[model samples]
Target chain A: MYDAGKIISGIIIFFILVSFPIWISAASGTIGDVPELNLPADEEQCVEDAEWMRANHMDLLIDWRETVVREGVRVYTASDGKEYNMSLTDTCLDCHSPKAEFCDQCHDYVAAVPNCWSCHVDPGGS
Target chain B: MNALYAFFAVALLMLVAFFGVWGLGWNTLFAVMIPYAALAIFIIGLIYRVVKWARAPVPFHIPTTCGQQKSLPWIKSDRIESPSSTMGVVARMAMEILLFRSLFRNDKVQLEDKKRVTFQGNRVLWLGGLVFHWSLLIILFRHSRLFMQPVPDFMIFVRDIDGILQGLIPAVFITDIAILMALTYLFLRRVVFPQVRYISLPSDYFALFLLLGVVILGVLVKTAWKVDIEGVKVLAMGMFTFNPVVPEGIGPAFYIHIFLASVLLAYFPFSKLMHGPGIFLSPTRNLINNSRAVRHINPWDYPVKVHTYEEWEDEFREAIRGVGLPLEKE
Candidate 1:
């Protein structure tokens, strides 16, 4: 190579950058981890299916807040023909108590800081 | 025809990815194996191409100069244009790579009234190219959160800043919108402009279409499909650590996004996308304009046996004496 030193150095730099995730994972001493949500043992079913809720919970909550606070509508008819009151504190958090254990599990894992905590309080204190 | 070919090719890739995972349920193949293979190919191919380029010798100081060259000490020289030293060359290259200084000076010629010709300054190409590159860079940085275990504070900070307008359920990133708009402008220019269309090839269209597919699919997966974020991070982290576990419940949209991204990586070193690295090796941009100030010796030069003037004079000494020619030795 004409400029072997410069070319090799450039390749080294590029390799390091492209494989940043690999080195980072190695340094952190963990391959991968899934957020462990503490589900209630006694409860048989949530308001909706786990899969749908996993993906669309934020949208559902946002819609619920608009319906309850702005439009003064309180009843939420789930897809399975079950109806429940649309209240974050009373309906959702009543079961998934202790924000740090349930909500914060996934939220902290994904680095999502929801503004829900600013207004609502955790029923099961940390 | 070129555009259609490129579009269909990308569509076919998407369909292959979708069917491969959704229909056949080859989760490991699409999610883990393909990504790893593609990343390896990308790295190896890039290094090979760079080495191949470096092997070819640049025998001349061929810097493309636009401004005044460094001549007399009194004459002010444009360092970033007609670079005369190493520092000046570095500055020139930095501007070329970062801001695309040369493209900023792009001009379009138009025939006026079928008689007069007018050259107009065009900044649209420069603007579109700049926007696309910068947006792509930011998007890549934001994606690092999926790969990192603890998710670095800086990455989160960058993501938060990008998602400041949080009116939507899932905050929209400004880069996503910018990249889409910039890509649209770039693609439209190639199709709409007669001059550009005439020179357009399938590879050019293919690159644009592939990138467009990746971006659109990425946006769809993030917003519409709403794949399990934890599952994706696990999969991403798995790939990095070589553990290679295919996480469940990540939608087909996510699979296709990853597959398309893998295709992009594998195709990178071979395509015009190599321009990402090739730009650094460009002689016109990287070389110093110091032909007058310093001598440049060709590395390929070799020692050769040659007859000198003195030897020729000695060999012709008898002939010179017979012909009555003057000889210094005598």
Candidate 2:
């Protein structure tokens, strides 16, 4: 059998579930103390500084000479945890030092006009 | 129990937040402090895990390889099965991790009509896993669009290519569909198959449930609700720079999505999900096959002074005479 009744009930539940975001958005202002995302619809959203990212503070730097048995080169990908070292030169930002050299070169290769380097650094090897 | 625990933890947090907001009207605490706290936990937890993993020193060269040993030409051998060369090992690891080649050919056995039967070509996991990982990679790539300022050309190109359909509103992307299907396949496979379910635990189920939750909620907020996309981007950008501000017009649903994502981040390095980084760190994967070329003395083995045979003979000379045994140089 098609089971129209069961399917219909499911559809009804689905709509209510789907409407959750709408409900929350609508309730933003009404519910006392709810943080209203009632952003002025006209507010031209400006690209703000990447505020969420906190600088990694740990001295994760590896002593290259000792670990990798090299004079200076140290950082290996974490996969070589035992025998390898992590160095700053391997940081993602080193090559993509500037947008033109590091970020834009490859991004432009694929034809991407990046805004990331404007605000954030490259995936510099940590 | 894992699902139940995860669900209850989520529900409890929601209820606490709801009440806190309603009762105290602590907008700043809810909107600002909690996110900062979560981010702190996330960073600390991630660092702790990485540091712990790094600090663990592997004392031996134990790279898991599959290829021919660099032995004598007369010593006939299968190269890929037991690799003893760098090139051979690299090829094997690459195939195993990137393509999941071994898993694709992996077999599962089950009883059929009282016969020990092996099912061949059972690649649901390998295929599902490949889809999930590949799709996730593309999705993460696509998300880079938000963090950029002028927006890089390649990202724009990818954006355009992803929306090549050119017909859907909000520009439906290939990765979105692919990730959805991938996660669905993974989840369904776990639930539908008896063999899989038999070995499945709450953690496995939780991984699927959590991913599904994120995907479902993401689709809900993105597609149907007509969310303020610009507002979300502002919040994301602001957060990335450490000036974490709750942008206006961003819905609570966004918080739930972001919150769940943050939870996943905090859980990542600790969870088996960390196998991404863990796989590479594994001594079995990174160690070079140099046993034949170089002697691997276990660095920790203490050297003990050996007693010479002359010293032993001297001590046992009297005992030997008592037993009428022959003596040397006597």
Candidate 3:
């Protein structure tokens, strides 16, 4: 009975939880790309390939110890190439520049405080 | 006392940080120094966590596999859910990372007669998270026009798409609603769910509140109180090129918004919010499940003298003969 009740409650929450994605997909389906149907099998690169990636993408490597950080979760690759970890960079700033007409107009329209300009930047620095 | 004291201290700091913008006239620090500090904290904290995890020894090939392992050809295997090969693992990771597939699979229990398994999608959290992220991205895109020497076309395209509604005064953008709803949902979920609430801390609420405060203040500065946007562009351009100087005719609310944003950035890496990057480093999600077919030798693995089967058999050959067991050779 208890398990059953838990299931019911879980189901309700699940539906509520699902509503967000469904709604988002329905609304903003046009933006971004997600390859869901035809997925690859191997997630990790072979040892040789990993080595090649390291050699080619040296800029990706940084000193973890001296680097600034945020959370309890860890992602570190050893200098010896024995350990490899990856995390997505925070790409929030690239779009929200203060000089851009797109951000200022709309952010202004809604009477919102725009923070895109605080740091030093040009309007379009391609 | 430590916990209570921490909460009040945080409250005090937030208040001070806010007042420094409104009252203390510390515009330079509010606009610049604080953001750098937060960014530093985020980077340092993130590295600290990752290094710590990297140091934890995982000798075994333990991946939370859901598909078929590479085994005897006669046996059928589930490939996508439980990946035995590297390609399968990649696909699995793609699904897990890009789409919250695992969270999507989360089942809710139902009770009436028999135990019911309702197949309602459980991706709302993921979607809200996505909305917040994507909307934030677009907002950033729109902002690029202000700082760039020559505005990018893509920025213009994205801005048009976001502000497609352009219905009322100043052209209403979609991000306003998206961010608002996303933030509300995340915040409400924390308060509503007992399980989530149990783990909820003041910092979590503070992050949401702080973001909300920035958004609100932004709206105020933009529509409610229009500021010199050209001046803002000059100020921002100067900041990016490392030649920051106060722009003339910029409003105080702009400073407030800038200060709060700086706070968000600096606070980003140290808070639980840093999970944005931590997900990729997760061993459970990233590690391949090829243990049965392949040996995963640890780089830090120490040397061990292992006895071979033939060596053991060599010693037991005489004993086997005594027991009348067939010998391969003789």
Candidate 4:
């Protein structure tokens, strides 16, 4: 007779690996409450739409870094015909000042390290 | 003819990637939506294929053995090759998976001077295959840095080792070159060898060409057109977290690379590329060679009605008496 034990165990292992995200999410319970960003109280609008910013803020910052540092271009024109300074500290931090409360919230939830603070100083440094 | 079709198919895919991202500027579709869809398909399709294979009952113990079976106590058994026991089977599978033992032993027959035939060890294909697979694995592992935050130390170590020949400004990884060269060799082998070319189907060529396209695009991304690294990480992280944000400022080249990769993923299970997992499920490779030691009973075997010799004799007793023949019943 064929050994059924090994086959069953293999199937179990396959399920465990494949359904890892499900069990992990169930165990962590953080899937329901993805961390929310603390918006600035004074600022009314950003360079782009909120959804666009949420998706592509890092890319915008990266482009800003290259233009400002490499090409020495300081002004950035948004798709909405609005012009803004291309400085992370001067432009972005002016609005999203508290890095820990605002940036770290979503970043920690997603486990993404932008590595921006390594060079640039945090405005709300503890 | 099949090869030409496959070549055109691969060209079409490249064209799709090029036009989809560069011409149409559909970065979100190429980067986020397609990848997510492909991943879902890959996972589900792989699981379905595996389950379908597993459910099929292998009633016979038909293990292909290359060495002598365990029979006489005096004779030495080739445990790794024949694999009569469970441990032997495990060892055999390990060797098969890790070293590609069967491929390593590949022999080629050549007709010399139109009279003499000579068998030569064909290690080139084995070497190409081994290097291609290993390099691919390492490259995939190294890419984990893009997916994971605070990239693991082991991954870093692997990256360092892979890029040990650090003369180039961006630092060239050994696997990058190895995979390209190995893929080229494999492709060339298919084209150059008449026998291989004769047997090669469209799917075979398509898989190879697609993989080559993916590797070339990846290399171009790393070397020629640099994209926003942090943005890439952000995008990868978003995907992992189920938030899937398409990052801006990443070059169209990156979009093309990702689209090609996504297509490969989506096509993986349905194509001949499924041999990666199918190798494990192969009864010839996985089964133990213990037919001599134990009788293999088919699980589906059931009893059936049959006429016995005694019953036949009893029915024919009257005819036998009439013919003056001896009967045990009478």
Candidate 5:
């Protein structure tokens, strides 16, 4: 308390900066309703398990791209004993079409910018 | 031996968190309660320590000056090195904090064969410290995506720039690699150099090992185990928003990472890590070198009762005249 004013001001600044996440969340609005993805109504099962797909979808997609473009192997075998064409636009986006509803929700929520859209176009409508 | 002790301490912590979550299934305790407790402790302890330091009166102008001070009108002064005014002090502090100006002037003295000695410029510590801190700042900023409701654009920009390599699956951040490399250099510098090794304590090794464990666990969870990031974010956001919920499918590595981070926060105020704030309060660096121009009265100085020469003469005047010593006072 010897230099009360300066010390108090410094502590205040440190407090505000360290608790920035809380202040930012309060200012932005609610606790943020978890992003709701519109699952495809027609399909009950995806190429892989939901948990696996949630985490490793990028790896799967990248593998498909490499296999199809470089190795010219056009078929993929899912772990559940199912075969499908190794194509992003044809097979993956075919089911999860109109990327905004399916892809953008979670991607935007996590602020992940997967460069999948750079080469492949999003099928406009389901 | 000290390094081994520190390493085992961190290993024990990692195992505790691992078992606390994976074995006993106390996800809520490891995830929510401990983190909240650690954050509260961090905030309160930091304020208390800083206030305690603030109460200690600096009774002297003790800035350690290395360059020419402000004196006569004709002589040029090194304003930043030997700061005499508030503006000069501010500029000097800025340079110290941002660029580590003093550390940049480090010199290493080495005995050349058996008798001769040589001095060489040594900037490795400064470079390592700067890289580590800057990368840590960037990583912390990037983590806002998990806690913030609507992630800011600038944070995303920083993440994108760090994750620029397109070939990797879960994009690799440059800061992740940079921080690990910088930490290795710092740790090795402490261990390999005989002089530094003599001065290094177990607490120093403990902090370094703890951070290493946290970062390595994070990288493993992200790339190898590939935990559900959405679930991780849910947990992070829940803690920040005060609506704590233990999310499912998050791996044990993630839990260990969070727990170690909490321990670090709780330990910060009591450890050398407090240097983060202590640097600002150091009298040697923060005080201005203006004792000549400005009188710095000690805060503890108090008035004293003293008998003056006139008063002493008046008290003993009659006694002196009676003894025929002096008869000036009629």
Candidate 6:
């Protein structure tokens, strides 16, 4: 009797705004499927474990870049005593050569625009 | 004092962020997991709080009236102040929310040297509240750039207007300075005003200190430290997409800034900061002053046994006759 219609409509609007993420995801047709990453076929093993790499690869890459570019420390000794050059172009691309297949797969899926390609030349790109 | 404890709590939070990221090397946990968890908790907690409030039934017309109500056609009604219609109520709420109308009318009472009490308008609190809220809104709107890809034109327009003073190397946002100044004023008001200080709780100070810490860290990141802006954007996008990645070259300072913000989000529903949404649910502000126009009945009112006047007269008929009191039944 006391404008229950207004209150009901207000509640409806509130729910719509609150559940926006769910509805947006539903509309976009990307609710549950995780981004499919393309693994390198040539290498059987990486410098680190798959789980560790998935989480901390960006951090490790940053450390490598800072050490190599700023401090002029090129040689990186892995925990397993494997010595590797701290060069993204030479070392990383040597294994994961095709940037589109390897990097862009996940990046595009997530809409993450990393600045790495801005300065560094993609080995896969013409 | 409670304020001291609150200050320490915020300090401890900052230390946790610093140590968690730098010392423990929990970059991924702080960067990805904590943000996701905080956001989930915030959404769930907010929904729960709002739903609980909505379910609550206000059985009475308890709108706080500050002016004349709607009456005889000749009598004028203060529609904006004592609203009696839906449109009037909307206008009232708009003024309250947008301009802080009630706060603007706040009065402070103080005893003068000659034992005379004087009431004066306290505009400082109103100004601080207005500035702080507006700046916070602007800052949040600007942050949309981090979450959205090819950020919306309107958000870009807001950013441009906020950073209109563009002579500096990194153009300074007006909201950045305004929020800090307003927060400081609010903090000092609690300290300097004896009446406010007496009523202040640890939670009150905690909210202010936490907000201050967040704003200060944000200012530091924007001005002092040069962080990877693109990397931060990448991280924001990842969080939204449920494919979180700790971006490269994002410095420890950025981690601390975000960690503090995450804490604020997680603490929001439980704290007085919930006033943002709670204000809308408030019966005193949102209800219309239409008690005279319409009779309000409590929906949950239950039937109760009652002794009617006839029944009372039947029971006390002899006593009433002795006292020479006439009854309707007799």
- The DockQ of predicted model 6 stands at 0.05
Q: What digit string (tens of lDDT, one per residue) describes model 2 on residues A1-126? A: 122353345445645543333343234432111112222234342112122111111112223324654555554544324333243333433433343443343343223342333544445323
Model 6 alpha-carbon drift over 4 Å, by segment: A1-126, B107-121, B304-307, B311-326
What are the iRMS values of all candidates? Answer: 2.1, 23.2, 19.5, 6.2, 2.0, 7.1
Candidate 2, residues B1-330, lDDT tens digits: the string is: 444665566565555554555555554565556666666665566556655666555667676555555578898654554566666666666876799766776866666787867566467678778988877766665665544443445656767777666333443567778778988887667667777767777777666666766666566665544345444554544554556455554445555555556566566656778676556456665555667687665545677999977888899989988899888857
Residues A1-30, candidate 3, lDDT per residue (tens digit)? 012343345345634442333343335442
- Candidate 5's residue-wise lDDT over A1-126, tens digit each? 166787799999999888777787778785656778888889999999998889888888888988988999999999988999999888878888888888888888788877788878977653
Evaluated on chain B only, what is the TM-score of candidate 2? Answer: 0.76
Query: Best to worst by lDDT, what's the order?
Result: 1, 5, 6, 4, 3, 2
lDDT of 6 at B74: 88
Q: Which is superior by lDDT, 2 or 4?
A: 4
Residue B222 in model 1: lDDT = 73
What TM-scores do the predictions have?
0.88, 0.59, 0.59, 0.70, 0.89, 0.72
Query: In angstroms, how far off is A116's CA in candidate 5?
Result: 2.1
Q: Which residue pairs in candidate 4 collide? A: none
How many backbone clashes does every candidate have?
0, 52, 69, 0, 0, 0
Candidate 6 chain A least-lDDT 10 residues: A105-114
Cα lDDT computed for each candidate against the true fold: 0.85, 0.55, 0.59, 0.78, 0.85, 0.79
Q: In DockQ terms, which candidate is top?
A: 5
TM-score, chain B, predicted structure 6: 0.91
What TM-score does candidate 3 reach? Answer: 0.59
Residue pairs with backbone atoms closer than 3 Å in model 5 (clashes): none
List, residue by residue over B1-330, the lDDT tens digit for candidate 5: 778889999999999999999999999999999999999999999999999888888877788997899999789998888987888888988888888888877876778788778756367788888889888889889888888877889999998888876455355788889999999988998899988898999899999999998888878877887888887787788877678767777789889999999999999988889898988887788777888878876788788999976687788888877888854444
Go through the candidates in order and give the C-alpha RMSD of each one to the true structure: 4.3, 22.4, 22.8, 8.4, 4.7, 9.3
lDDT, model 5: 0.85
Tens digit of per-residue lDDT, candidate 6, span B34-137? 88889888877876777677666777878999889888778999997999798988999999999999998887677989999886647788999999999998
The predicted structure with the larger DockQ, 1 or 2, is: 1
Residue B97 of candidate 3: its Cα lDDT?
66
| Candidate 4 residue runs with Cα over 4 Å from true position | A1-8, A11-126, B108-121, B302-330
- Each candidate's DockQ: 0.55, 0.02, 0.01, 0.09, 0.59, 0.05
